[model samples]
Target chain A: MKVRSHRAGKLLKGLWLALVLAFLYIPIIVMIALSFNASVSRAAWTGFTLDWYVKLFKSKQIMAALNVTITVAVIATVVSTVLGTLGAIGMHAMSTGMANLLINVSYLPMTTPDIVTGVSLMLMFIFVKVPLGKWTMIMAHIAFDTPYVLFSVMPKLRQMNPNLYEAALDLGCHPAKALYKVIIPEIMPGIVTGALLAFTMSLDDFVISYFTSNTDQNLAMIVYSAARRGVEPTMYALSTLMFIVVLGLLLIVNRRNGLEDIA
Target chain B: MKRSWYAAPYGVWMVLFTVVPLLFVLYYAFTDQSGAFTVNNFVKIASPMYGLVLWDSLRLAFFCTLLCLLIGYPTAYFLASRDFSNAQTLVVLILVPMWMNFLLRTYAMMTLFENNGVINTLLESLGLERIQMIGTEGAVLVGMVYNFLPFMVLPVYTVLKKMDYSVIEAAEDLGASPIRVVSRVVLPMSIPGVVSGITMVFMPAVTTFAISRMLSSGMIYLVGDMIEDYFIAMNNRNVGSTISLVMLVLIILSIGLLRKVDPDNTGGGLW
Candidate 1:
């Protein structure tokens, strides 16, 4: 009886594990499988077809949207990467309540809901007479994306040995040169990861882009407008494309961060 | 010690973007561009629609948070204690879904749960043809739980992994059953994780409009939905900002209340 009960318990545990993982992945799996469904209509799975892939390349709007998204994401990533690194470095010199306050405020954008962030930032930008275009979108993204970059780098910045910089200084290196030579090398991982994170945020962001985009700004806005038009048959293609990109990003980040670290 | 020309660029970005936008929020919170320094916007948020919407938002958010806690705790404990060769795979599985736009997920959920979608079709194939899943509170819950699962898992997993196994071993040595050990020992130790998980899920769930809009078929207008209407539909920045200020106050008060759980106030429940 004891042996039977122990076997049953193990079986039950296995059942629970299967059930949970299946529950999490079922939608994603269904979506991926249907991407190959010859029917472009996500409304149903009629047949298997790859014609959507062919048509995906034919749409100029999708291409334009893709261009805007890539351009905007690249710019935002570069800007946020630079400022965030500097901010993290600048923060190391100050060990005060002010630093903590600045850190918290920097993170407010990360915590605040996207709708509020989008609307408020849009209003602020408009009121300030900053024209709402690609630049405004970049500015808005930078406001929020910097926090992620800062969060990624700040702790790593704090952990580095100050003596390395001191040693560089002693060798007659200028402060900027010491920063470039010593500080940069020490925090390379943080910088790379932070930039990747910023890029992800830029690429995936919807709320800010929705509020700030004009006729020609980002892919998220394009997808939104397309969906509003009764689920553009091409939207599923766009979604499938997005899934691949995000999945690729996930794999890359996981390998970089290491499985043990994520666990 | 020499601040370069680059300092000016940093200073300019800070002023033009972060510092100014925040100051703009504060200044707008007080002003009355409805032509005078009046409190009319604050009064407008007191309307029945706003009140109902706020109540709706709170109700849905609480339910979502409760669901997350129930689903997340065991999963977090199991994952945190495991020695898997590919835990990264599992973490990424939970995380990758979040990278897609929220709007896309909401729309995809509609396709799955709608009357003509897979769930019903599957149910019909299985001989239960009378079930309704979409355009209901259940659909809202599904969306919230789906989107916010990672938020709950990440913090709780972080905390649970840090819990000392020796404490549990001590309990076991004292002749406590696994059930008693968990309830009395492990759960209490994970309060910070629980707190953070709840906060992370609750904050966004309460303010989300897209989920409600995409799933609810207009029968339900959450506070988030109401706030969206105020700004986008009615063109009432005054009322929208007022509601934001009120929500901000409520959120701050909630944070203060939760802080009482931490003796030292070292960090939030999640941190």
Candidate 2:
């Protein structure tokens, strides 16, 4: 009797998990299916075709938005990663009170709702009379992205031997040379992880970009506006392509660092 | 290069972008059109129109959080309890959807709920009448839950995975049923995760504008939508800033209260 009950419980758990996964993935699956469908009718499956994917590449609006998204992501990732790594190192050497102050300030951006962050940054740009455009978006992205980089690098800094940099210096290494040879290598993993995170966040960002951008629309902004107008098969093609790329990238990262790092 | 000086650039950036922008929010929140100090912006939310939007936001967010917890708790518990082959892959599956552009996924959801979309189409083929899924409160709630469900799952799963299994065995040895063991021992230990998950899910669900806009077809208005409209559509920065401030205060207050419940402070480990 107990054995049967145990088996039944296991079945129940499996069923529940299956239901939840279905809930999560069904819409995504539908989108993928629709991407290849020749007909716009959801009820009927027409002949398979890649026409939408062809159109996706040919669309100037999408191409422009994609270009802007990649450009902003690359610039934001580089700037934030550099600034954040240096900041983390500097904070590691600071007085506890001073570091705490900066840490608290960092949390404000990290924890605040994106809408508030978006709104406030928009106001700031308007107040300072900076024209709203890609540069402003990059600045806003850097503001939010730096804290994640700092936090990621901070843990690695904590784990490193405190004397590693000083020992390099004692061994006749110049200050910059010591930093390059010892400090940076020690924190390289964190820096890479932080940079990847910054890149992804900037690429996926919509709310802040929406508020800050005047004429410069990223892929997300374009997708939002397009989705609002109507569902387009071209969007499904774009989503499917992005989904595959993101999945492949994540799998590669997972293989390198183990699933725990990203998840 | 001195170590302290390394952070000077970061400090400057933070002050310029982070600190100064927040100050702008405060400035606009407290000032009127001429920039003189005034509380009129705060007073404006007292009207029934804005009040209903706030209430709708809280209601939808509340239900979304509750449903996520209900579904997510079991999924996490089961995943952690059973020794599944390739458990790491299962967790990865949960996260892959998130890496897809947030706007795209929400848009995908809209297609499923549209009048002639996949779900209704399927119903029709099954010889059932088509149902109106979009532009409803239920649709908005589903959208919120769908978008934020992973936030509810990951933290709880992390906590449960770290929980020692021997405690459950001990409780069972003491004549506790499996349910009793879970309820008595496992549940208390997972409170930290639950707390953090609630905060994570609730924050985004409450603040979301686009999900509600797309899923509800503009029938629903949340605080986020209001903020977006004021700043973008109406160009009323003062009122927008005022609403943003109020939202911020509510969020901070709830986070504080959640921290009080999970006194050990392990609740926010997701950060």
Candidate 3:
């Protein structure tokens, strides 16, 4: 009787998990399916067609936003990866008190509300008379993205052997060369993870970009505006494409290192 | 070490951007139209209209956090108790939806709950009453739970997965019933994950403007939406800054309370 009840409990648990999974994926699947429907109404499905996908490509505004988003993500990723990797190394070498202070400084941005970060940065830009545009957006992205990168790289730094850099110096390498050749290769995994994370964040951001951006619109900002006016069919197509791309990237990353370790 | 000097560039950048910008918000929050120091902006929050909005925001966020915990804890436990390979696959499945754009995900919920949308149409075809689901408080709550559920699941799952199975087995050997084992062994040890999940879910839910705006068509006025409207629609920086400061204080207080509950701070990261 006990064994039978155990089996029943296991079955019930399995059913509950399936229900949760269905809840998570069902709405997303419906949206993706509606993207291909010929009619604009989300309630009724017309015949399937690739017309929305074709229109998505042809829309000049979406194309512009996509271009700006990619550019900003790439620039922010590169800049934050370099700065954050260096900052991690520097913090690793500092005294405990100094390192703790800097770490707290880094944590402030991550914990702050997005709206606060958005408005405060907007206020500062206006105060300094820096025109809000693509550049301001990129600057804000770097500011937020760098902290995440630092957090990522710091764990890897803590795990490294402290004598590795000194050994390289003893082997007749210059300090800069030793950093580039020895220490960097050791922490390359963290740097790569940090870069990818920063890229994804910059691409997905809307709130901060909404306030900091002027005439230049990123993909998220465009989507937000469209959602406000009732989302266009072309947005469904764009989101479907983005979903596939991100899923592919994540799968590739997961294969190399366990997904749990990334965070 | 000399390498410590490498942080100089980032230090300067943080001071200029991070420190200065927050200080600017503080200045704006406390000053008047002509830049004279004043408490009027802070006093505005005590007004009935603004106070109600703040209360509603906290109430809704608390409910969303509670719901996420209720749903996520069981889901996490089931996954963690599974065989290793199966558990890993399920974790990936949970994470897949999270990679999609946040705005798009909320928009999908909007499409589902619209008056003439898929759900209502289905209800009508089944000879059921089609209730107004969109532009309702319930819709906003649903949106928050949907968007932030994964954040709750991941942290709790990580904690549960790391828990030693021997401890559970020991409880079973002690003649404890299944319920007793769970309550005495699993629940106590999982408090850190629960605390982390609460903060992760509650923080975003309270500060979210996009989900509330999309779900309720601006009918819901959470603190976040109010702040966004003040800055963007009304173009009132002073009032917006004041509201933002109030939000910051509330968030800090909640985190402090949660920290007291989570003394050891075991589940600190998203992973």
Candidate 4:
């Protein structure tokens, strides 16, 4: 009787999990299906066509937003990755007191509310008389992105054998050469992970970008405005494309981490 | 050159961007339109109208966190208890939706919750009345639960997965019933995860503007929306800064409470 009850409980749990997963995916599936519907109205399905996808390419505003989004994401990722990796390495060699202080400072950005960050940064620009545009957006992205990169790289730095650097120095390698050859190779995985994370964060950002952006728009900003005005089918097409790219990138990352079995 | 010198650039960057920007917010929050220091900005939120907005935001955020916990705890518990070889795959499936653009995900919800959207269409076809759900408080709650559920689930699942099975077995051997074993052993063991999940979900849910804007269709207003209105719509930096500062204090207090709950910090990182 006990064994039978256990089996029954297990079956019920399985069903519950299935229901939850369905709830999560249903909206996404609906959106994708509606993107291909010939009708513009979300409620109607007047046969299927790829007209929205075709029209997506011709939309100049959307194209411009996408261009800016990709550009900002790339530049922010590169800049944050470099600064964060070096910062992690430098902190690794610091006295405990100094390192703790710096680490605490890094945590401030990540821990603060996004709205607070946005408002504060907006005020800072106003006070400094800095034009709120592409460069300011990039600067804000870097400010938030660096802490994540630092945390990622810090773990790898902790795991590395300190003697490896000393041994390289003893082997007559210059300090710069030793760092490039020894430390960089050892922390490459963390750096790559950090860069990918930074890119995704920048791509998906809306609040800070909303405040900091002057007249320029990113994909998220465009999507927000469009959504407010009743989303177009072309917006659906853009979402589908972004979803595919992100999914592919995540799969690759998982495979590299030996997590492909989960895929 | 000292190796510590490498940190100088980041140190300078943090001071400039993080420290100074926050100081500017504080400066703005305390001053009036004429640049004279005044307490009016802070005093304004004490009005009944503004007080209700703050209270409503907290109430909604609290309910959202509670709902996520109610749904996520059971789902996490079941997944962790299962001995199936493919359990990790299931967890990954949960995470995949989060990788999608959050705005798009919320937008997808908007499409479904529209007056004549998918759910209503299905209801009409079934000869049932089309209930008005969009622009309601319930709609905003659904959006919050859906968007933040994964944050709750992942941490709880991680904690449960790491729990030692031996303790559970020991409780069973001591004549504890299944329910007792879960309550006395498994649940306590997963407290850290639960705390982490609460902090993660509650922080974002309380501060979200986009989710509320899309789901509630501008009919409902939260503190976040009020802040946005002050800064963007009204161009009133002083009032916006005051509210932002207040929210910051609340968030920091919550984090401090979370640290107290999970003093050992076993469930620290979400990655």
Q: Per-residue lDDT for B10-114 in model 2, tens only?
A: 999999988898889999999998899999998889899999999999999999999999999988888888557666677778867767777878888988989
What would the DockQ be for model 4?
A: 0.67
TM-scores (chain A) of the candidates: 0.90, 0.95, 0.95, 0.95
For residues B54-139, write the lDDT of model 4, one tens digit per residue.
88899999999999999999988988885456788888888788778778999899889988888999898899999888789999
Query: Which pairs, if any, clash in model 1?
Result: A38-A47, A38-A48, A38-A49, B196-B270
Instruction: Supply DockQ values for each candidate.
Output: 0.42, 0.78, 0.71, 0.67
Q: Stretches of candidate 4 above 4 Å error? A: A258-263, B268-271
Candidates' interface RMSDs, in order? 3.2, 1.3, 1.4, 1.9
Better of 3 and 4 by DockQ: 3
Root-mean-square deviation per candidate: 2.8, 1.4, 1.5, 1.8
lDDT of 3 at A101: 86
Off by over 4 Å in 3: B83-85
lDDT of 1 by residue, B1-271 (tens): 7323333344456556665665555556666765356677777667886788798889989999999888877777766654444554555566566666677677677667867666877887788874676568889888888888777877777777778888887997999986898899988888877777887888889888778877777667787777677766786666677777677667767767776775554322322
Residue B10, candidate 2: C-alpha displacement in angstroms: 1.3
lDDT of 4: 0.87
Question: Worst lDDT window (10 residues) for model 4 chain A?
Answer: A254-263
Give the alpha carbon lDDT tens digit for every residue of B217-245 in model 3.
88998999998888889988899999998
Name the weakest run of 10 consecutive residues (lDDT summed) in model 4 chain B. Answer: B262-271
> How accurately is candidate 3 docked according to DockQ?
0.71
**Candidate number achieving the greatest lDDT relative to the actual structure:** 2
